[model samples]
Structure formats: C-alpha cells, structure tokens
Target: MSILLYFTIVPLGTAFLVTLLRKKKGISDLLAVLSSLYLFGLSLATAGLTKSHGVMIYKVGGWFPTIGITLVVDGLSAFLLVAINLVAFLVLIYAISYMERYTDKWKFHALFMFMLAGLNGVIISGDLFNLYVFLEIASISAYALVAFGVKPQNLEAAFKYTIMGAVASIFILLGIALLYSYTSTLNMADVAYCLSDKAKNPLLVFIWVLFLAGFGLKAALVPFHAWLPDAHSSAPSPVSAMLSGVVIKTIGIYALMRIFFNVLGVSINLLSVLMASGILSMVVGAFLAIAQNDIKRMLAYSSISQVGYIIFALGVGTPLAILGGLFHLFNHAVFKSLLFLDAGAIEYSTGERNMDKLGGLNNKLPVTGYTSLMAAMSISGIPPLAGFWSKLIIIVAAVEAGYIGYAIVAVLISIVTLVYYLKFQSFVFFGKLDAVYNKIQEVPLAMKTALVILAVICVMGGLMLTGTFRPFLEGASNVILSGTGYKQAVLGAIR
Candidate 1:
C-alpha cells in the first residue's frame, strides 16, 4: 500500500501547499516542481524494483480475498506509471513559464498535479470500481483543465468533453454493475478467476460492448472523437501535450488493453474489432489533418491517426504486432508531446497559430524551429528516427501476420503522416518570415528546455527497443500476452 500512498500523496500534498500559499507564486512553483520531480523519482525507483522483484501487490486495509481494494504494480502498470510521470514532470516545468501569459498559474499547477495523481491511480488500481473512481478523478480534472483559458471556444470544448465523458462513465458504471451482479467481485483477479469457471458469460459480452464504447470515447477513437480537436487545441499547450501524449493511452487504450486482454480474455472477434477501429482512425485522421489551417487543430487530428496505428498493431494479436504497438505507444508519446510543445512555443513567441500567417521562424526563433523540425521529421518516420523504427515494426508485423491489406493501409497512412508533417514544417517555420512577426521573441527559457528534452527523446526513443530498455518493453508486453493466463502471475504473487 505504500506504493499507492506514495504516488497519490505527493500530488495531494502539493495541492495543499498551492491552496495555502496562493500569493507566493514563485514558492508554489518551486513546491509543485519539486513534488512532480519527486513523483518521477518514485516512478523510476518503482521501475527498478519491479525489474528486480517482479509484480508488487498491496492489499488495501490488509484485507485478503476480495474485501478491500488492491493496487497491483506489474510490469505493464509500472511502465505506464513511469511514462506518465516522466512526461508530466517535463510538462509541469514547461507550464511554469509557458503559463505566465495567463493568470492564476498556481491554480493550474494544483489541478495539474491532482490530475497526475488520478492518472497514476487509474493505472495501478486492481479493482473495477476503484478504477472507475480514479478515471473520474482524472476526467474531472481534465474537464476543468480544458477550460483554463476561459475563452468561448475553451468553455465550449470543456462542456462538450464533460458531457461526452459523463455518458462514457455512465456506460462504464452500468457495465461494472452488470459484472458485479454476475460475479460478486470488483477485484480484477477475483473476477477473472470466477470468470474462467464459466465457459463464457453472455453478460460479459454485453460488458465488453459497454467498455469499448466508454473507453472509445476516452481514446477519441474515430467515431467518438468529435471533441478532441477543439479541446486539445484550445487548452494550454502543456495540457495539450499531456492530453495527447499520455492521457489517451492511459485512459483509453491502456485501460481497454488491460480489461480485454487480461481480465475478460482476448478473442479473435475482439481483435477484429480493434483492427477495424485502428484502420479507420489511421485513414480518417490522416485525411482530415491535411486540411486544417490551425496549427494545433491539425496536430490533434494527427494524433487520432497515429493512435490508430498502435491500436491496429495490438489488434493483430501476433507477438510482433503487439511489440510494434507498444513501441509505437512509447515513441508517439515523446514526439507528439514535443510537437504540441513546439506549437505552444510558437504561440508564446508570435501570438499566432494559423499556418497561413506563420513563416521564417527559423531566422527569428532558431531553437524552436530546429527542435520542431527534429520532432516533425521524427514523427514523419524519417530514417534513423524513433518513429521510423516503430512504424517499420508495425508494417512488418502486419505483413508477416498475413494482413497484407492492413499492411498496405499502414504504409499509405505513414506516407500521409509524412505529407502533413512536411506541410506543417514548411508552412510554419521554413518559408519567408511573416512580415508581421518581425518583432517576436524566442520562447521563454523553460519552454525551450522542455522542447529540447522531448526532441532528444524523439531521436533516441528507438534505442529503447535495443538495449537494457528492451527487456522493460518486452516484459511489459509479455504481461499482456499472458492474456487470461495473467491470473497465474497475480495468483502466484498473492500466494
């Protein structure tokens, strides 16, 4: 239980400090930064421990067998916790300076930390009901974060996001109620164990549909993705980076993967559904992004497309495909965040985001321009970059799995991904300097630092699949591949 307490306490503590010392902005910033940094350290330490000791389980209230909640930190959960905290720490530091343009920076920081706590909680919770509660904690905070700018579009986006989120939550809760009624257990392992006794429950089929729709909304999968562009683009950039970078993965794909593959048991039919959704996202996201003039809007749509690739790979159900999907998830987190932060830096410097009005940024803001270019090329799947390696893995997985049609679609979508990134690069930073932007200054130092960190990661993320990090990624993927067999690992730990 120390694991859960440690992760949640740091953020909740920082929030208290923010509330108590509202007037001391500098002090609050320092406290918030330190809190996030400490949390990141905790996540890293957790990673190392999990590497050495394997899955760590903390039975809440010392209750055994199904009475209280359980927080299980396995390879997969540990990996995501580390990823979420890692980016959140950088984004928090970026927010310290980037948020200066707006008022009430401390409020932003507090809410941000709370949001992180909720995300970590969602990733670690081993019970369905507890997972829902943490999902709410993160979703509610996200709703407020979306409206932080207080612009009409911001408010509108937040309202839409909230309403959709509510609908999704209701669906999820209803499904949980159904499952609880059927199995009388909220703990995932208990439910799975009980489920294995029943050959296949019809109620489970219904619950599966509910979960797909509910988590689909969170993931911004194609049909359920209406509010993402407005909300992500309008929110402050750090929030945008976090939203696209890791939030969707945690709340949507990661949750879906866990419940389906580990808890409910994966089936060929479900894999088909996953692949179809993935393909739709890839094609549609790429096509729509090519038409947007707003810099952030375009990038938001692109995320929808790229995420499809990961979903599709996982759906393919081959070991190679799952590896590719997981790898892409990690790489996308880095480059996509960097891209959004780069957009933020542009807005900070020039106060403009329209591609039509942006030009010649390389001359005026060399760091932002160069860093963004690295991100663009990396995201576009240029050779030697992380994106290229992951994409190669996915395509190879598709071809080797004999999903030749999907492989063709994957290659085509990648080409499309490149087209848009090149368009973004040429239009925003490489052409004649927009005459109107002559007086613009470079991005604030803190923002530049975050961008640089992400850019370097974008370049090096591929290395993760090759060295010591290779085991980390493979181990986490193996947990998912464990499928219903996951019970063996958890049950063994409990014994």
Candidate 2:
C-alpha cells in the first residue's frame, strides 16, 4: 500500500480497535499514543518523500483518474499533514494524563482517532466528492467530541456547532452539485480543466458565492464565527487544541484555497472578497476577545483573529503573501495548540477557567505558567518567536501589494493580540497567589512533557524559515502560487 493510504487507514483502524477495547484499562491510551506517534512519523516521511519525489498521485484499485478515486500529495498536502499530525501527537500525549479526570477515556481516544482519519482523508483526497465525504467524517466526529463531556454547556455548544456545520455542509454540497452539472466531473483536477475555458459563465459566480459562505462559516470568519467560541471553550482541552489547531485550517481554509486557487482560479474580485472578510474577522475577533473573562473563550476568539491574518495574507495574492499565509497557518497551529493545552492544564489543576478567579499560578504550576508565557509571547508577535516571522512576512507582503490600509489594521490588531494575551498572563500567573489555588500543584509528567515540547517548538519554529526547513514552507507556497497550473501538475504526476 502507498504510504499516503496509511495516513487515513492507521487512524481509522486504531479507532475501531479502540472501540472494541473500551473495557480494557491502559490499552486504549497506549493504542491512542502509539497511533498518533505513527501518524506523525508517517507525515514526516511523506514530507521527505514529497521533497525528493515531487507530487504523488495514488489511485484506488488501479483505476484511472476521473474514473477512480485518487489521493494527491503535493507540497501543500504534505505541509498540512505534518502540521496536523505533529500537533495531534502532542495533544494525545497531553490527553494521556489530563483525561484521567474524565471517565470513558477509551471513547475519547476512539473519537479522536476517527477525527484524525477524517482530517487525513480530507488532505489527501483529489476528488471533490471524496473531499466532501471526508469533510463530513471529520465534522461529525468533531461534533461528538465537542459534546463528549455531556454537560449542559457541552451539549449546547455542540448543538450550535452542529446546526451551523450542517448548513455549511449543505452549501458546499449545493455548490458541488452545480459544478458537477456544469462540468460533468467530480474529480477536482478535471473540474479545474473544465472550468478554465468557461470563465464568463454566470453559474460559476453562483457557485463561488455558495463555496465562500460554506467555507467561511467553517473557518469561523467574522459573521460566520458565532459557533467557535462556545464550542472551543466547552470541548475538552485536548479536543479544543485539535479544533483550533488544525480542524479549521484543514476543512475550511485548505478547502477554500483548493477550490478557489486551483479550481476556479484567482481573480481580482475573489481576492477583494477574501481581503475584506479577513480584515473584518481580524478587527472584530480582537475586539470581542478583549472582553472575554474565560481564558479558553479568549483563546477561541483569538483563533478567529489569527486566521484572519492568514486569509488576508493569501488575499494579497503575491508569492510572498502566499508564503507568509502558509507559514502563519503552521505557526498558529503550534502556538495556539500550546495555549489551549495550557488552559487545560490550568483547569486540570485548579478546576477554574475564568481568568478573574485564577491568580499566581506560576508558583504552583511552573511548567504550565512558563510554557503559556512562551505561547503568549509567540502569539503576540514578539520578536525571535515563530509567530513574529510569519506576521512580519504577512505585513510586509501587504505593504508591498499596496494594501497599506490592510497592513495597518493587521499591525494594530497584532498589538491588540498582545494586550489580551498579556492580560491572560497577568490574571492567571503574575498576581498575588489565590488562596483557593494554594493547594494546587504542577500537572502530571505526561502533560508537562507535552507542554515543554510544544514550547520548545514555539521558540525555535522561526528557524524553519532560514535553514534546512526553508524548502518545506517554500514548497507549499509554490503550490498555491502555481494557481490553476495545479491541474496540469496533478495530471502530469499521474501520467
């Protein structure tokens, strides 16, 4: 079997086995960790393979393109795979100790693996219909995971998320149906080839609107962002990390980029729309986050804002802008996941998430406090951290593209990001020790190990832009800049 197939299959097979082993103590956790480790290793191997071999196309059952399902791994897919799996493996490691407080740990592992499978499937799918199927698989698993706690708030958040998610799915399906009607092909590359000659079609305009709304909602961009805060805050911390770290990027941003850049091709109008939405999300999410008392809720809102930076960078539509956007996507996944895990660690120790109620945690939970400090610094675009480089690239790209107003807003909002994260640090870690948390202690070894590892990444991730890691980011950027040439690239790889 092709290595690409393992990305989806390993998680799926593990999920099923975990379900059967639910009654066995320790076994489920062991399986979950091992599976995640394997997936991370596979993702790294795939990246190396792609770097050496270029684009790879794997057809299911020896069938030909347009007739058989295909998995295409180019630079973009490889980059996302590595980001997703790396965060996932760390999150799983955190979960091993953190989840001891909750019952039915096996079920959590099972759902998590299912979600991983869905994410991997989405990244690799070359068929539009297959992408939708994998999207649903991931979405459904996420909804269940969000409600895993079965508390009133968890249920409420999951319901709201499901309603919004179902509507988005409908919009995407409608768009796909219309595109299929026009082009008579479900294969994404073939659809791109068919659409290239019909640039002026009015139906194409309608399809674009549908896809934009659908993907925008999934990505939690501004007006479509109501569901994110509640869901991210209510879900388990590890699950929240997964949701904010990768789920939005894979199902929302990645899908939108694939459909718009590779299939419909970039246009001035589309770029403008993306830029406008991004700016709105960046400004609005920041302002809303400032008022949040819940640490997780603040982090959730910050996600919407950071994602805005990414979308805005992509909308700049220059090679540098695209590179910055992809780099930020990876950086955000790392630090944001770290931040959420920190939030979880705090809650794990003190059983409180409201910043107003928490104080002087650094004395009790030194690892969590310091690691969170690193993440907060990184997210705030402080120099020498991963976040600063990507944000700098994006702001410079905007200035170069003559979107000076957008660049200004990005800079101002970045300061806003710093303000709130500083608030988080002060409220949770720096003030007088709360009498209530006096008995609290540092989290377990597993949790500390995860936090330390992610913090180390946050510190050094910027180096990726300079040395041996440069090609990984550049390779993904090249794919996006290639635009509709993606069709030729995929077809040529197959031939």
Candidate with best lDDT: 2
Q: Can you write out model 2's per-residue Cα lDDT over 309-363, one digit (the tens) per residue?
A: 9999889999999999999999999999999999999999999999999888898
- Write down the TM-score of every candidate: 0.99, 0.99
Itemize residue pairs with steric clashes in candidate 2: none
- TM match of model 1 to true structure: 0.99
lDDT of 2: 0.95
Candidate 1 lDDT tens digits, 290-312: 99999999999999999999999
lDDT of each: 0.89, 0.95
Candidate 2 segments exceeding 4 Å error: none
